[model samples]
Target: MDSQTMRDLVMYWQGVTLDDEAASRLAALSTSVGKTLNAVAGGSMFDTEPAHYDRALIAMAERSDD
Candidate 1:
């Protein structure tokens, strides 16, 4: 997309106007997702313990009726 179209889409997703600082921060975060994926591919320090991950699917299912 052209810069103007991309800016419009970003503003829409942000649900408000994008000032310079906020726009830059969001763009930085967008770039970080790819960096995180690359780090995960190399193996993550945060993934050492399986028990640290909470699989709350059963709780979510029970709460769905409420």
Candidate 2:
């Protein structure tokens, strides 16, 4: 996200105003989180914990009336 956009989002959503240093820190944290999420997403979905998603979906489908 753009720095300005992130700052705007922080203000809009969190009702907080960030100075330059805080904005830079927030940007770094946001970048780290994005990279971490990307790395996690690169792994196989089946290996995720509690990986009974397919079974849960099947159960949900069976329970659906239509």
Candidate 3:
């Protein structure tokens, strides 16, 4: 996700007003997490398969709903 989206998500989950500095820090952390996720996904062969990934996501969502 982009920085704006990440910032919005952080703000929503944090449920507190953030100053510019705090927002910047959260955005940086989001970027780092995104990079790490990309790296891990790149290293995984299973993630390359779209259908399986979609199915896994669906399964997880179903479990959460249950």
Best by TM-score: 2
Spell out the clash pairs found in candidate 3: none
Instruction: Report lDDT per candidate.
Output: 0.64, 0.82, 0.72
Local accuracy of candidate 3 as per-residue lDDT tens digits, 17-46: 666677777788878998999987776576
Question: Which has the higher TM-score value, candidate number 1 or candidate number 2?
Answer: 2
lDDT tens digits, residue span 1-66, model 1: 334444677778865777666666667776788788888778655755554234655544555557
Candidate 3 minimal-lDDT segment of 10 residues: 43-52
The order of the candidates by lDDT, greatest first, is 2, 3, 1
- Alpha-carbon RMSD, each predicted model: 9.9, 9.0, 9.3
Evaluation by lDDT, superior candidate among 1 and 3? 3
Clash pairs, candidate 1, are none
TM-score of 1: 0.41
Candidate 3 residue runs with Cα over 4 Å from true position: 1-8, 43-66
- Residue 26 error, candidate 1, Å: 1.3
TM-score: model 2 vs. ground truth: 0.55
Q: Scored by Cα lDDT, where does model 2 land?
A: 0.82
Once superposed on the true structure, which residue ranges of model 1 sit more than 4 Å away at CA?
Answer: 1-7, 41-66
